[model samples]
Target: MVIFGVVQIIFSQIPDLHEVWWLSIVAAVMSFSYSSIGLGLGIGKAVEKHADYGSLKGVGIRDVFHDADKTWSVFQALGNIAFAYSFSMVLIEIQDTIKSPPAENKTMKKATTIGVAVTTLFYLSVGCVGYAAFGDNAPGNLLTGFGFYNPFWLVDIANICIVIHLVGAYQVFSQPLFAFVEEWCSSKWRNSNFINKQYTVKLPGYGPLELTLFRLLWRTCFVIFTTLVSMILPFFNDIMGILGALAFFPLTVYFPIQMYIVQHKVKPWSRKWLILHLLSTVCFIVSLAALVGSVAGVVARLQQNYKPFKTTY
Candidate 1:
């Protein structure tokens, strides 16, 4: 997110902000895999060590495969693949945004800081308005609140950012899935873990056709998906608002707070736990309302879009 912030700062100053957005997306795609793969793999390892089904505690290697299969199924339904891929890209862009310029470039550093500060102020201002209007149950993106406030121009700007943010999130989420697939397939085929499999280039005559076919199919599917999304762009804000509150909000805000509270073993007297516990509680409530409220907002939007007219003349 810091990287994206930095990119946003630089790109905002540039005349071609759209180009910058694309560049940021590309950078995110490249970095997502490396940044997030550890998280899923770590979970898999933990599960392998634990979650013994009593009799299966000292079983063969088949336990690992069985657990992996279960995990993969859950991952598919949770839409983690898309989310991880997108978040990865956004994370890199945000990092770039927040990073300090080279020491020698003092002028650029100062300017960058000023730029980020201003951008942060803008974000904060929107957040304030959003929170005031919707209280703790504000949508994940402030733009939805802007729309509720009946600001058309802000809505348009929010739409643009929403697209960029979604693309980045998709890249972030996809990383773990790609990593899991690569690891699982390699391990299963080679009878060894993925990292241990030495790279081999013994290409048979069928290799070119297979590679070409895969590329063609992937690209075709992507195009179709893009078209479908474009067709549904009108309601993208509402969809994202609900999803952000339900999935992203819980994972990013609530889970971390709860995790830290548990990790630190906070007692009733511990200020840290008390604060975090309160925060988690508040966030939990807010998330619930945000999920429900965002749905209401969507329904209202649909009504406004397709309202029934009455003749008064």
Candidate 2:
């Protein structure tokens, strides 16, 4: 989306105000989506799960194979590998970006604050301008959508942006899982394959014939799986949200509460945290129900007919 905006800003013939608006909406949505994965839900639960499972060292090959076996197919296994690699890459990038500056100098603190504030204001301006120009015609994507309705040139620019944005998103999203596998491989291998991974911001290198072989086969499958899905379901944003909500939402909310309950067993807990835990669990349950209910609502909405605003000859 950021890439889309940058390209649109550079190439779109839409009024400056209108271009800004569409870009703003896409940016806001992307920010929220990425943030939610990293902080809002998944990260917390993953930490607790790892701790409970006794870190990577405590797990065995059978455990890995057993888990892998449960995958829907060989393709799904590959998808999981690629997904992990992608997730790790993103996490590492974010960690590096966030960490390097803080450790380097005291001036970074002030600079960071100013940078964030300016970015926020810029996004707000875009949103306001987009709403003013498109009104109800505004779609989630400025270039792809606006071009469809108004000007083909605007969409052409948007398509370019979307391609770049997809690459960036893939680069970031794959980091978390990639880093985990890389670290695990490093522990087992003394070779430069693992060392070379430090330079590139993509998937990390592998070692240990067993682990490397598994990941190679797995990641290959993942690319194919994701490719098929992307082709079949091109509605990326909403689908991503729904998948995130179900898998991530549960993993985030329930796992932590389980950890806390287990950690504090035989001890009385304070009412505040207890209440918070209860509320968290309830929210998850409600969200699950709402998601299920939405399917029916979508079907009903789709089945409804809309009147054409004009007559054709």
Candidate 3:
């Protein structure tokens, strides 16, 4: 965990997401690498002798996982699924950085459509294949939860690729948050040199990079605090579930619908407005359910056996 945080801290120093465009490219490749590897491993497992044949409907609602009600499991699953597609918060930030010969929105729309479609398909394939491989006994995290893959060495490689992919994803998702806080601080403390001053340091393989003492200190602390919390909690899926459920409806569903209504000037109570609002309401319900279920799961885990740093995946 320390090493992961340290690596993130280093990448976080790159100033902004725009400055490290290559990082996303590399991260995308790493994502495909690990995902493809997992898919292949799953296929291999499924074809092997005595392979598990899972139910088409998956685990029942009355089923139990780790002594928790399957209803909560359903909720957690919804949260994770929602989180997988919740990129709206960072989507605008990325679109803002595009170098446009053509229109930026045009590029963004094309990218967004293709990106989302491709990712959704890949995730579905992975989930389906993984479930088929392990059936009802499938682990929460197919990659890490597996006791052993037939070719364990490939698992190690996949793990490395995951770390690399996350290093980029962390910055992609977090840069917006960092930028928001830093900008707010700078505005409030305009006269404070500690917050306003910029220092240019020439580093090899990079141009005269502009940095600030406050940026370094603040970003480092943010990484440290988040890392510590992660280590202490020893919960992965539940935390992701909570974050997903909390952010998905507001950022991805509600705001987008509201924006569309305003941008298109669709009259209130009109067919389009009604449809959009209806979609948003259904999403809100899903998000609420996910949030409640995830929170309950976390509480259950805490009560059962949470060893913090001592807990192993």
Indicate which candidate wins on TM-score: 3
- Residue 18 lDDT (model 2): 23
RMSD of every candidate to native, in Å, equals 20.5, 18.8, 1.8
Between candidates 1 and 2, the one scoring higher on lDDT is 1
Off by over 4 Å in 1: 1-22, 25-119, 125-173, 180-230, 303-313
Per-candidate TM equals 0.40, 0.43, 0.95
Mind sharing the TM-score for model 2?
A: 0.43
Ranking by TM-score: 3, 2, 1
Which lDDT tens digits does candidate 3 get at residues 123-221? Answer: 899888888888988777778645466688899889899989988888998898889989999999999888879999888878788888899999999
- Candidate 2 regions exceeding 4 Å error are 1-93, 96-142, 148-154, 179-215, 247-271, 293-313
- Model 1, 136-204: lDDT tens per residue? 334444344344333455446445555565455443344334334445655666654333433333345
RMSD of 1: 20.5
Ranking by lDDT: 3, 1, 2
